[model samples]
Target: METEDDVPLHLKSLAAFLIRHHSDQLRSITLSPDPKLHYPLYIDFAELMNEDPPLAHLVFSHPIDYLRFFDDAALWAHKIVFDKLKFEKAVEKIFIHVRINISGSPLECPETFPSIGHVRVKHHGILLTLKGTVIRSGATKMYEGERTYMCRKCKHMFPVYPELETRNSIVLPPSCPSQRSKPCEGTNFHYVENTIICHDYQEIKIQESTQVLGVGVIPRSTLVILKDDLVDIVKAGDDVIVTGILTAKWSPDLRDVRCDLDPVLIANHVRRTNELKSDIDLPDDVIMQFKQFWLEFKDTPLKGRNAVLRGICPQVFGLFTVKLAVALTLIGGVQHVDASGTKVRGESHLLLVGDPGTGKSQFLKFAAKLSNRSVITTGLGSTSAGLTVTAVKDGGEWMLEAGALVLADGGLCCIDEFDSMREHDRATIHEAMEQQTISVAKAGLVTTLSTKTVVFGATNPKGHYDPDQSLSVNTTLSGPLLSRFDIVLVLLDTKNPEWDAVVSSHILAEGEPGKEKDEHLAHIWPLAMLRRYIHFVKGYFRPVLTKEAEKVISSYYQLQRRSATQNAARTTVRMLESLIRLAQAHARLMFRNEVTRLDAITAILCIESSMTTSAIVDSVGNALHSNFTENPDQEYAKQERLILEKLKSFEEFPDIISME
Candidate 1:
């Protein structure tokens, strides 16, 4: 039977053209000794087909046959270069990876490509493209290309190179070729050890990207196989465009009727899609709406910023400061990387600790929906491994599987019920929160995975809010963990009849049809436009603090330090950094190039609200007082003087003082 290694007659001409015109490119690839340095030779399929009329007709009419022929041609071209170079030791290392770019083709268009839900058996053996997010990636392992089997009865050795179409099928040779006393059936053949040629292999699971899925529809995923140079190219949560051939294999266990078999993509090329690319092109109508909004609020930046805060979670009533903080968390500060390769993360982390019915969960869900890429999980259902990374057995070898935090890299990770998470699981996020990376040292795999994700956690306080309890104690979180958050807003279910009536009216108005036409509500940008505006800010805006802003922030920090009590939840340098981040975010909201003093003052006010509510202060009727008294040295000195005066008076008039 003909095999894949046999080059077809029609492909020989293509092979000749590749050797004649692309010899230098092949030579350079062969000279690179490192496998990691290997780069695929990109070829334009349209251009190649235009050069060869016969090949063009065959490729369009019979794609599968043309693909096989193209593979053979690539192999032949590589062999010719190997012979010409005279690099005998490197001949086997020189692999020709042909990546065909199918531009402007209907089959290769992202919109026309079949989703995992629409894929069927008819798609097998055809070239296609897929767009999705990688949910899981298996460890790279060696895949056997050619195997040698030895018969036990006659000790006869036979070589077999499995075809790509039937690579996963379970089949053994019918009979052995040894001329023994009786022909031995090769039923008891054993694989010869150390006689197999292997290639690099990895498997990844891809789920449909969120933008491609319909509303309220759960995403579907499919397995993809990547070999050789393509292994280890992508990680979980990466949005990718994959171009490859679809192939199906028999089930590992034939008795399993529920899942008999499934198709897998053998990826020929993979490209990472820009996560923020969709934000650049806002719809014309939405842009016009935003322009009108700008016109209304252009005179007052503060009014425009408050409008954005109100638009974040319009359904929830009366937490304007908390909503503003959340908005800043979404539009993060500028990340700084110095010459020494040290990186300072600019993404802000927020924690919302509230009463049972204070809309914490609703706000979290709203934030998750607004972000372009986000993952939502509850602490009760989450594990340490599930939040970070876990080692799992695949094909008798351990593989590293990405968790929620890892998968949410470069996005937001919303962990609801933060107080409900186990102690160990809660501790697992410390490194990720501070360093912005996760380090895995399990199953002999030692690698650091980037988790540049903004963590937005929400939890209910323990029982009721007590004046004596600090924020950390109320939330059941340690001081070290609590200090990592840039802002910790405490939401109380305060009862005010006037405020309650307003909230009730807003809730009722939401169900009414004409409420949106109100003049007051007209200035608020549509939810879609608001989300795209945030994305645009994050992509383009990186605000720096001016001298005035820096001075204001410094003064506020010093004042807080002087007033802070020993039991204050967050009084460290992290708070100072948080102030800077908030100020930068505020500037970004106004589309300003630099943070002004007004921005710093706005940030300070938000921080003070969070600190005062979360901490326990002893001052009488002073809401802004930190949990500690100011000027402790002066108070102690005054007490000492009063004690001295009393002692002197007691000594001078002992008889009259009634010493008893």
Candidate 2:
């Protein structure tokens, strides 16, 4: 009974194509039982539109209307394929979804392409493409789409589709459909819980990638709803491009004046974009400049490495050792799995404890910007659950959510105000730091997640830094925790007039006009190029320690152990491991295939400098006069006894010692 105008042109054409190629699509679907892999037919929208100009014009003009007709056409194709396959009763339960891939001409259409932040009410029911980072993902659950209701008076069964706009509300038919002489009151409708068709549903929050936004601007996020085969397609921290329709849901509670429910994207197809590289598109000239930089620095890797180090936080003057260590930490060592199934973490962990105005937070923020996958968190704000993983109740079911460390997996996690964190929260990262894995046993969920995160922790010392206090005492950190870090650098505000003058000059120069154009300024990589360089090294290079490098490292370890005046608890096997890791990282920075003796020496020098700055050793490389001694707590007692003995000796000379 439908007229020609009532039916969309694209829908009729799509039906004809499905009837023609029904067997081919059905064969592809039957091969894969997994819902994720069950996407057998991918209708290329661009190709279809190109073959039919009228259909393309109709689609381009009325996209939202065409999308609804397209869904119906896909459903009709699904039925045709399902019937042709003659699938078993059990197999029929698994619905094979038909996904539409938009590329070429369709992607060029302005109406189909919209930024995540630009989606509005005008875009409702319109199919659009969006690219963003998945910030949060909810657990998949079965949602009842259609429910059967029975009339209590006549026991008449009726099926109804509930509107899921508001939080918790269901709409029923005004009256029963039974052809009774007397009209039945809609109030007597009883819910039939058993007869319901449930579909897999999930919600995810996608935020604009940092690369797309201007510096210092906060990213915007949008809620996306996935149903049936699309549920659980993506996870947190994934950069994805989704093709879906913009839809809005109404608030369930009509009494509430404020409508809290926002428009959500109902996704049909999701594709993961590579996150290892910078998402920002660069100009042709800028890309060429990066290639030229690589060519110029390919022979002299050490020079290139130094340039990169100096470039990071140039405003913060004079912490060469700390800067170098941070640079190496950014390009971490190679992960290795031994024959015995032991996995050694390749990531480097650095802890910076310094004076109040020494730019510790600045370093952390710079590192976050430099790395492609990085997260910055503070001690006061982050919790044990927030750092690793936590269980949350979503749709009446407990779902595991990823935290900062988990979300920053295979990348960097910068923690500012490290000392201000609670002891309980700090204890949670013990396993994650050493083993590179977080084990969660909460809410009846027992699972271990891979962290693979390099920790960059910055802290302030307790009150004024005392040279007499050990690193642990100064920072209020445990000995075990301190030992885990590959390098612990301390920055002090010393009274060197000459050094202070140099720092002052640099600070003053920053405010001057045309300072960026000064030829005297150190040559540093651009932010985009620097990020790309890091990604290149991490992805392609995996340097191993040579025999000479191994010998150098072994000799240094033995020498440190033999010259120990006090029992060096800090000097453990972990230190030796850290030494090797640093050496490997150094080699990677230089674009070398193997760690040389010079790399090992550089690593040792870095460790020695860190130890000296931390006040663990004196200027001449000897242990300081403090704890790590035999009975350190008894020092006060020893001092008191000596005082008493001295007083007794002075008993004979009462006139020399006057008593008030």
Candidate 3:
């Protein structure tokens, strides 16, 4: 008889029954006196719990064995207590996540195992226990009230319930009502109509409650990748479930796991799982609002706000970076907002530039799971017109299928193998990036679609971006496309041994000791909330620049552009405009209705710094320096005329000129 006081509230109900059932087995157990017993036993227990049948049965075979195991377990118990205290202390020092990972094979299977068991981890010797189960191999993805197929050949169907036998599928309704909402249909039978179709060798169907069992043949496509199989497998259209610690800085959106799977993993998962044959439904308002935000930034002050925004999100590059930077500049400096009651748009871009194992593809997988908005990753190699802009078709009036960009509007669009992208196909993005809209003119279906998205692109630099080729000429990207981005961040796996250690340690910490905690994506979330806040402010406030702010901006740009060439100077002007917008945005962040001198000065410093960097680079930088130093503008024109005149004179008097 277990006393109520001896049991925790959560475990009290089951303790009495469990003790009664295991009394015979419990009586055979004993504790060993060996000092080293706990450490080895703890390892053994962890291994056992990780397996299916488990090693707990060994404890019940004899008293000596039980005693030995208990002694070992004691040391582990103490370690857990010590580790918990250390974890608490660390948490107070900083709010960052700590992680660890350990590895071991499944526990040995034991005969006559109990229905339930406990798994515990002890750090520095204090034990923390958790209840878990070793999932049986034959288990299927099935749930109550779901429908089972009687036979694919005969098209037989039946409801899933306690009475149904030989169940092999996990019940996955179209959506979870508790988390989302259940589809409202006439009968429980209707719930399974749109449920995922699995193709396996054998089929099971309900004949009549207790008599329900296997039927005939199954579909060839029935072997959709299971959740457990996701680590190594990637098939198109399959819905995959993955869980991992979120890392916000590595990708535009937060990534769910540390695994190195690519965006194709999710793409394949969706392709295999969903049979809808149509595009996922996306709200139009979200699309419109994203475009509006992009356009609004054109007039917003940018200088300091751009720096602040980029400082906040360092991973993205190009048009994606520019758009967000512009948006943030407007919101923080100008106190601007979009038509939708949201702060400047909260979006991200991903630039994957390297060979395999560079985390280009894996980054996409992580972002998909971490973002609040939908994640759509497409292949530059396999993607078609239907993958980007709206494509036209038959008598259905060329219904628009929201491609990755369309769906990812107001969110993220990750593109893999970006260098492999077809030139014509890549051109589709030019309009989208600059105009914030995708214009389609294919199959007589000319229409404009919203592609206001943060494009995360991955590509391998040609021959590792030839260091000898000069920074401006060697870039694999075309000048026009490169120019679209506000910043171009370079990622390299340096030869630093310390970097390797840090990366390895970071991955390892995810699963060990007192490191297991929910990975917080607060950085990304705060930006989102800020966007909403900006929207509120814009709806209520209209900010303007003061004379001092305007004059300071004017004088700053005049001084900065003195050395820049004609075209390069134009960029400076644009930079100044961006700075002004940013200053206005900072004023907004400070809860002001007008740009202040402080905001203008802050914006100016950041803008001037970026201008300096851009102006010093090869192509734009040379052009900028030439405008002032070499007088190349007039000198080059005269030099070209002189060359032409000399060539003509030489052609007319070749004999006399040679004699002289």
Candidate 4:
């Protein structure tokens, strides 16, 4: 006759009777001036630290593990629950708790206790309250008036002191008042089951007082899945809160960690949140074309469909930063996946080289997080099988889950530690990068997976870079793979104390991080919106060569000959395509009928700015052919001097000889 909800119904009646006149304010209240800071309840963990001493010299080893145990309310009531708790300037010794019930004992208690009450449990041979107060130490133990009790029915023994009341005797409110008031009411407790209340943004849940289960937190750098409503809040470019079951990061050995959430959650959240409405001002005909393209491509899924690419073609005035480069790179591109996983596909790939601590990893992480599809990172020694094709024994047959490139097929693959990748694995990507597909042959599984991945990768200088500036690709990535990338952005961590101050201030709360990085959603999310924009334009974008644009581009190739040995005409043409595609994409973004002169000009300028840097290097390398052996100290000077010399020589040297 007793169902679970019925028992809660019973307890609700008794709780109301006992607390009918009590004021709600009697619950916990914490005061702190900084709204951003969390005020955690502290306990004297010094005692627990002493009892469970860690390995020598390992102070608070396994902090994450230690944090996990506090889920038990028995631990909360007996060892951790605090009275008048405040951890202001002091290190907050927040003791996490988890409960384990002792059966076959004289204590005739229910299987679990409610979260609000004092749980009576035995630990370390002592009968203790959940608040860490000793109810009854033991018969042989020394305590004030410790009572001994025996249950006749169970024939088991327990130590019970008169001060501790039985659960049936103590009646209270169904819900804790602390969570029912003001801001805490809606945000603090989310109703799950009829009797269960999830606290702390629903990432954590509390059972009855006897048991507290705590799930592990995802790494701050992790890609996590958000719930349906939470996904809606996170629009493209807008920084939205994402909350869901946290999953563990993949280990080096690729073993499963049950601690994290399922991947299904991520796929569903991305699909739902990526939905967008068509721009209102678009022509009816364009809209029809857009719809047709969506239908045709909807079921024909490509790799890398998660990144939102925005193309802005303004002239370069300010110095380039990773944030700026990544933003620029996204303009007019397809976010698809391949054998490599989710990637951003553009006319050109991007390679970033810099010193350590230059915010390279941070930039990559930000882009990967913002992108709709998955972003998989790999390092040196990462195998082709591990990255492109992974085979598993599936029910007596080989099953492949796919590699980072394959998963990123329709999105971007931003690889950190790029130079560390083994040459064989590095070689495997050359085809994928160029052909935009990977042909696999393993265990009789041969197929060409779409690999239109736009690779945004970073690496440290081979050794210590020049103490003065950014590291060049000549030093970090192999020349072959380096050539495959569409654009190579150099991130320099400078010592200009003023810029350093600004960066530090921004990362800290001292200065506002430009526009919250969240406001860009209108231009950022619905990567599908932009893709449709591209699809609409490509149908009629029969881009003819503007005589002026062609001349400007040809002059660019001639200038390249005046500078370096590289046959830059191919590069020049590729850059032209990148510009055309980018122009079309930008035109779409602006709701234009067709690509215009302004669009082409904008694309030309951005592309030329990047190519100019390469041209300068080419000229410099030829002039100083003997001085630089790709060695360290001389490399920067060699490259710089070569560029300057080429700049000077351009006036005298004929274009053909200087170029290739």
TM-scores of the candidates are 0.76, 0.75, 0.36, 0.41
lDDT of 4 by residue, 1-660 (tens): 223353343234322321232212112312223323322322322333333344111212332222332322222222111233445322222222221122222221332211112222211112111110001100111122223333333333333222112211223223333422342221222222242212221111111111122235221122332321222222111111121122232222334634332121111112112222212235787577545544553432110111122222111112332333455454444333558674444434666666676656766765564444435476764687767766555324554435667655545677888888887787888878877778877677666766656678877767655524223333544555655655565544456666555545545563444644432322233433444454444344344444544443444445654554443432544454455455544444333445554444344434433442455434321110111122322343354344334543656433422221
Lowest-lDDT window of 10 residues in candidate 1?
A: 619-628
Off by over 4 Å in 2: 1-12, 15-27, 33-40, 43-94, 101-119, 130-135, 145-162, 166-197, 207-221, 250-260, 274-301, 394-397, 516-522, 563-569, 613-660
Report the C-alpha lDDT of model 2 over 356-449, residue by residue, as the tens digit: 8778898898888887778788999999999988888744667677788887776789999999899999999989999998988989878787
Local distance difference test, per candidate?
0.73, 0.70, 0.37, 0.39
Q: Model 3 over residues 40-95: C-alpha lDDT tens digits?
A: 11123333343413233343233233333343333233333334555333111100
| Clash number for each model | 1, 1, 80, 83
Q: Which residues of candidate 4, in runs, are more than 4 Å off?
A: 1-321, 333-347, 466-473, 501-547, 566-660
State in Å the error of residue 12, model 1: 6.5
Candidate 2 structure, TM-score to reference: 0.75
lDDT of 1 by residue, 1-660 (tens): 234355566767877866766777777765667644435766666666667767665654565556656656766776666667775444434355677666444345534377777787676766777777887788777767668888897788877666555654435667786656877766678888898767788889898765556778887888888887789888876877787878775544435456445678888778776554543467778656656766876666556666666677777765766777789998988898859998878999999887787878888888987888788899999999999988887656677777889877888999999999999899999999988999889989898988999999999889887646778777889888988899888777667577677778878877987654433533455677678878877876789898867766775576566567843669888888889989999888877779976677667766766674422132212221111123433443453343223432443333221212
lDDT, model 1, position 245: 78
- lDDT (Cα) of model 2: 0.70
lDDT of 4: 0.39
Q: In lDDT terms, which candidate is top?
A: 1
